[model samples]
Target chain A: MHDRISSLGEKKLISRIISRSRSVFGSSKLMGLGDDAALIDAGDDYLVLTSDLLLETRHFPDPGRPRDMGWKTVTVNMSDLAAMGSRPEGFILSAALPDLELEFFDSIMDGVIEACCHYQAPLMGGDTNEADEIILSGTAIGRAAKDRVLMKSGARPGDLVAVTGPLGVGAAGTELILSGKSTEGFEDAVERSLRPVARIEDGIILAESGLVSSATDITDGLVSELGELMDASGTGMRIYEESLPIGEEVPEIAAILGMDPLELALYYGEDFELVFTAHPAGIEELSTMMDIHVIGEVTGGGSIEMVDKDGATYKLQVRGYEHLSPA
Target chain B: MHDRISSLGEKKLISRIISRSRSVFGSSKLMGLGDDAALIDAGDDYLVLTSDLLLETRHFPDPGRPRDMGWKTVTVNMSDLAAMGSRPEGFILSAALPDLELEFFDSIMDGVIEACCHYQAPLMGGDTNEADEIILSGTAIGRAAKDRVLMKSGARPGDLVAVTGPLGVGAAGTELILSGKSTEGFEDAVERSLRPVARIEDGIILAESGLVSSATDITDGLVSELGELMDASGTGMRIYEESLPIGEEVPEIAAILGMDPLELALYYGEDFELVFTAHPAGIEELSTMMDIHVIGEVTGGGSIEMVDKDGATYKLQVRGYEHLSPA
Candidate 1:
């Protein structure tokens, strides 16, 4: 208790919570915390439950855009369910709002309802309280076949590591907004950032095909999510930087901001895309169904390394989310 | 859009949300918003889910007591489940923490774990974020037999109204702290406020016995909760003021503060006790198992009235929780 939480870091603090919260009545929990979502054994189908918190100025780039804030709040929670290969059943929104206009509240609710309609998830009831700032906590529940539920484990060497779609657009969107740059040419980046959709269909396909091994959503950057998958499966990834699907607007934003597009793709998170490892044959079949980028291969090596077009390899740094800090 | 949320008030805003959020995903939702908890129709059993948010300065009387804060966060959510006669299976904490000491963090976790153990609910998983304030949102998931699921409906005229336990201690505790009074003579009141436990067993017994017609938890004062029950069940209540089991220190604290003890019991809430209506025979059977106070009878007159010791009858005021405000 004397040790500062910042000294321990977010990863270690999360580890501490996961271990300490292990309770006695745990017969029905197929998977507890620390994964994309927790799993409960609900007879025939496993109940997939996941929650995510979003603060107004902390998570969003603008305080005036309540609609986007509301949209992202639901998507972030559903993305965890998607990462688990589960179909979202319902969403529970827990909001703490400060004093605000009724119009802003409606706009936020409009965004929430729009997302619910898009995801085909019901807006279940929620709890509300008054606070100094706006904080949205969304808990999404989904159901997946007991056998088809995915986790951040079971990856084996020789499997192909792939992403459901491109990366960096979300980061670019964030960059553009933070930099106050006009979105004249890079509107897609801002759009992707505001209305990012989870790869739910791809995750379900991966689970049903039974070809995928370990999977996680790329919300906290590729390297960080890969670190989680590797830790859970006792494996590492050898990523080929050249094979990645970088967003069309990523390079332009990087050039304007004097940042490397590759760096944005690798470390700047909030993409909400699926990263999975599957057999080569499974990758081929999945490619026929939907677009995917085979960016690497699973390996027994204990460290994550990336190989560039020049065949130069270096360690991929894993910087866990920079949210929590010590007092 | 032009109206302020505070101008609309909490009740109207909540009603607007419930109506507007009616989504396309309809099946499997036994009960949606506007109840003690939401119910999902899982195959053999109903999955009960509820969430309650606590703010550092807003909800707690003291921000220094993290343990009580944690304990109350879990209890308040579980109280919702208890109102529905559901057995809590797991508790998920959605914490938006600030730059606080690690010791404070651990102390909160300790309280969470302690409550989970007390209620026999596993600490499932949770989502955490760093915010400017400490916002603890606790979500509890429970399960109950589909037939025995209780809701805020189904009361009938001539039914006896009862409470699982005494009231007013929690309000007394709040008054003492806010008034900055010494607790030397009112330690029990403060204790009750800091450590209120939901009447889970009583709710279950009332549900399983098939005698109780309706139930709701007294979290927002007896009158407020009773008003909810009345509105939902299309019946009013006739309470006997002399029959109420006021907490031991309620009158003493009221005397010291120059307030009525009955006011604390009637309008001051946070008791986490069950208020249910049932048949007289069932009350007899339940009385043998546990102590209960028969406080009133359900009436078809569509008005909540109370009979005092002097045979005076008057309308019982329903002041809903005063939290939300217009910005």
Candidate 2:
């Protein structure tokens, strides 16, 4: 008795597949599935491996320039390694592309090369094939000290929840592009959406400083990421709606789009910012070292609650970026 | 100027991409792009990384069972590492699938799990997305002793060229399937094509014995692989047509299909067998250890020739599986 994958959804389908799979390396693997990346013991350090897939019309609806698409492809995979607090080592890219102009291929590769150079991660090798549309898959490998590796399952109750940078910038940028508005004053938002940077250095700093108890990256909105952290850590969270670190242009863009600024900050994803939990005593030190804002506290229960400024509380919905759902 | 990708061809397109991309790791990387896989120096051993893309129609035109497609997907990437004489460790699989029956997804994952278990390569974490068609990408990470890794650019003149197993079986299998012929006596050939095995043990044996000077797996026919070995080693080859290893059912299948068995042996691809070069003295030992057939000898010049039984020589055409070619 089989059901449609659309009915199961992406998350349930992945969980089913992972449940059916068995681990070949039991002892040597530090972390296996369900984490941002897999970690294996490599003698002196832990090697991190992660893979990401981006499809045309799905990941990038209007991938304006090929170069930007290439850059985003690598950045997305690298973001996983950043969540694990690993140093970028290298990546192998496999692309299934349609018959396009050579200039388009060149532009896409230019973006890939530029991003590699920027991150100091070399392009090792890859495979290319012909397909109906552009589908890019990148597998990034990195290494980290075993003691300094960050995990989502290590949060404790009462830990302060924080973000490395402001949220909703990527979502605002997406709005500008989709609305066909001039990005004169919203350059920062558009750039954030088009070229989101992985917070690799910040993750490393948090992990090395022994400040972060649990960490994950905000690719699928703040609430979604917090839900994952809570699921992994077996903890709940109390988030302050007023404490959300929203970018300056987010509110203006939200007003223009007739959307709630707080809703955008809580729901819009692809920020690629590090969301981590730390002890309250270390919050000031973390803020002094980097642009971090305390937004919540890990609670004892297993439900997420958002408190408004007027002392009203609402249960945050678990909806985020879901793939394979009917539009 | 914009040119169509078809005119540039797949190989040329890859070359252009590799030329445009730069290596971020200068001294630490043992091998970068343009190899079976990239080799990076770990602390004690070399880490091998490779990625391969498989599309639904392009890769598996008649992917009879979902399990077979999944097995083939992982097998293809493992074969790349096999060419490098690296031991299989783990792999990350990223899939972009459309809304399909749950049985299809289950069968595919079953095949992937079975292959991983068989190869002892654990399944790490990966990304899944929705697409118009089924697209699977696998990135396999492996390890090898720094001195024991095989490379394509190490063959010297007078080295004997050999293959691990019979050639033409995969081709004959394809023919049988395409013709809808009976498989009473051609079961071996059909199995070869449907479930080809990667010669991982033979590769490791050859590498550990210090016998193989250069090696690569036969995924794109014998002549194409030999051509790559020749180009990488800066040498030529003289192959004996009578020495071509044809399977038992190949001749009969060729007779039925009105095709030349020897031509199929040279041009048909997806064998997943190891082709290597070594000194004449080591050939006998290698043959004793494995089912290796001596088919040719490396020469000083840069051209490939095939000598028939009657001593008539013909210049072998550089025809292999070329993707995106105008048929």
Candidate 3:
């Protein structure tokens, strides 16, 4: 596979990616993209580093579009920064391409460059190699105020539950793709699956306002992510089913696929949307930047409950990607 | 591929890698490895991050041997860290496994763990997915003392050239492998090609000594790496070919294959040895380390030359791996 990929000139693709990346930060970087390794400036504080890998058949859906694949790789890590309430500074991209076709490779880079531009984060450095399947990995670095970083373990029992943006669009769109259905009129819904943006700006704003008590991105479905937040924060949450904001295209695709819209919303993964907790007083301030709906409230019990519109309540069940679950 | 990988239990090979990682530096890291995002101890310093990819064919040999493949993955990045003279504290291993067997994956981890032990680095995280070929991408983080990290551009015209160990054994052994020759009595030599080790300790020592002016690992052959050092430093060098250290096992393989030993030593890549430049005063202290040898001298000529054994000189050229070079 490496030999097959070797036929494609990696340096050319890397050169293109580097040229497209703009340096928004100052001149402290001793070396950036295009070098064998990157050199950065570190002062008195500790440096934060993280790396993520997106396989063609793992972090994304099979038969996934290539441009979306590229976008997903970058946004996922950016979402990590959002969870930490860190302002992204730069990231390093490493990709293993199956072939060396310049046109195909450029399209992938175009998607990556677009995300970097959208987030105002520069491409610091990267590695490009060839493999049988397309593999993308990124290491992102960000900065945060000393006492302002949000954590998954900081939620209190009385914290208000909120999420940035609606749910289920990405998973619903993916269901359509699986059924050989057209997504022409539902570009936004499909894009939610392909190019879901990370809520970094919202996270930073909430953190700076000293309003957010805890934060985590919804990579897994809503219920699964909520479970993680609950486990981490040692508190349960009570959510109202009617308050759930379903995407416009979600119900249509869910109906066609014979899937429950609420179930789809609860189980849709890779949304890269932020689910955070704050005090009731902080809710109005956070809603100023974007409409953050109060979906629920943290409870003392260690179980999540959903109150249906029929005035019945039940334990929320999560069914999504679990790292240890059998295939 | 992404869907297939995502569907597979996350706790398979990659989670195992991450589970072994230890965060020794601090306690404020909210997210380490398990979550979609990692929360780091983002203090005052700008984070230092670097990544390198190991391709089975380009970085190692074909028909990959699992242990060496794993070792090469770690050593390549270690060399990158050595170039910057940074102490690698953490790494994220992202891999695309061609085969998901326990034995094959275990052997790869054995190699990575060996490297971690040697460098005193920890595997803080990783991502795994399936591919047509085996791929390893490692993102390493190290805290350098302020901005005092060494770079390739630190060399001066009056500096002395040095190498950590003998070269060409790896290349010669690889030649034997490619030619389907017998590995009669040269187990050590064959191991050089298969299990190349990086000069991480040497890098740390040299960085501390503050003697080495510029440094880079011999990944793209001696001449190519030297060319990089020259390009970065804007200076040239004159290497005494007679002074080159060829491993004892290298000569036997060279004689059996009827290849020029000197040419093999100079142009053959994948040495993973450290090639550095230092001041004349540091030579005595450098010799304290085992096998440290001064093989050349830096000059203002902006080109590299080799002075042969018979009082003859020739311009050394780079025929090492280039992405666009004809295979």
Q: Model 2: per-residue lDDT, tens digit, A257-281? A: 8887776788778788989998998
**lDDT for position A31 in model 3:** 30
Specify the highest-DockQ model's number.
2
Give the alpha carbon lDDT tens digit for every residue of A86-141 in model 1. Answer: 99888888888876788998898888878887887888886667777888888888
- Could you report the DockQ of all the candidates, in the order they appear? 0.61, 0.65, 0.11
Candidate 1 local Cα displacement, residue B198, angstroms: 1.8
Which candidate number would show the highest lDDT if scored against the true structure?
A: 1
Pairs that collide, model 2: none
Off by over 4 Å in 2: A22-30, A258-260, B22-32, B179-184
Model 3 sits at a Cα RMSD from the real structure of 11.5
Predicted candidate 3 versus true structure: per-residue lDDT over A124-216, tens digit per residue? 554555556677887777666646666666678888999988888878877777677777888887767767888888878876888888777
Residue-level lDDT tens digits of model 3 in B82-125: 76666776555667655445556656767776676577665554
What would the TM-score be for candidate 3 when compared with the true structure? Answer: 0.79
TM-score of chain A of each: 0.95, 0.94, 0.82
Reference contacts recovered by each candidate, as fractions? 0.57, 0.71, 0.14
Which residue runs of candidate 1 sit more than 4 Å off their true CA positions? Answer: A23-30, A325-327, B23-30, B325-327
Q: Give the Å error, residue A110, model 2.
A: 0.4
Per-model TM values vs. the true structure: 0.96, 0.95, 0.79
